[model samples]
Target: MSPAITETMIYDALRKVIDPELRHDIVELGFIQEIDIVDDYVHLEIQLTTPNCPYAENIVAQIKRAVEGVDGVHRVEVERACMKGS
Candidate 1:
């Protein structure tokens, strides 16, 4: 059997998704939150700096793409929320 997916692996994958405006990865930007894994499925929330961010859709797509690249990940479900106090 293939190796099980871990939070570390997921985070590593997420590091490749860069916020075009910030030119920085979401992991470093601390936007990733509430990572939950079940079997081959992954669920996570992304807290954007602003609710009206123009790039939100693109960012979510990138996040799905990145998370799906993990070896054992069969599905990725992403939710978006604006950061508190933002």
Candidate 2:
């Protein structure tokens, strides 16, 4: 069986990714909608408070960097989604 992805690892990695506007980690801000690991790749669905948020690209880049730092991660794929309300 494949090893499970621990919540602690996920949270720790995500904590390194900050939301520029909120001045807090994306995990703390609750912007990470979901995380999925398949093989060695990590897929992330990230939700921003607004569709037109100025820091969207920066946030995505930071998230990719953070996730890629994990020991078993070979690639990081991040998809952006807009939150229901800003």
Query: Taking the candidates one at a time, how many backbone clashes does each contain?
Result: 0, 0
Q: 1-86 in candidate 2: lDDT tens per residue? A: 44556556777999988777788888888888888887778888888888889988888888888887777777889998766754
lDDT for each of the candidates?
0.92, 0.81
Misplaced by over 4 Å in model 2 are 1-5
The segments of candidate 1 whose C-alpha lies over 4 angstroms from its true place after superposition are: none
At residue 16, candidate 1 shows an lDDT of 97
Error of 2 at 20 (Å): 1.6
lDDT of 1 by residue, 1-86 (tens): 66898999999999999999999999999998789999999999889878988999999999999989999899999998666776
TM-score of each: 0.93, 0.85
In model 2, what are the clashing residue pairs, if there are any? none
The most accurate candidate by TM-score is: 1
TM-score of candidate 2 against the unseen true structure: 0.85
Shift in Å, residue 38, candidate 2 = 1.0
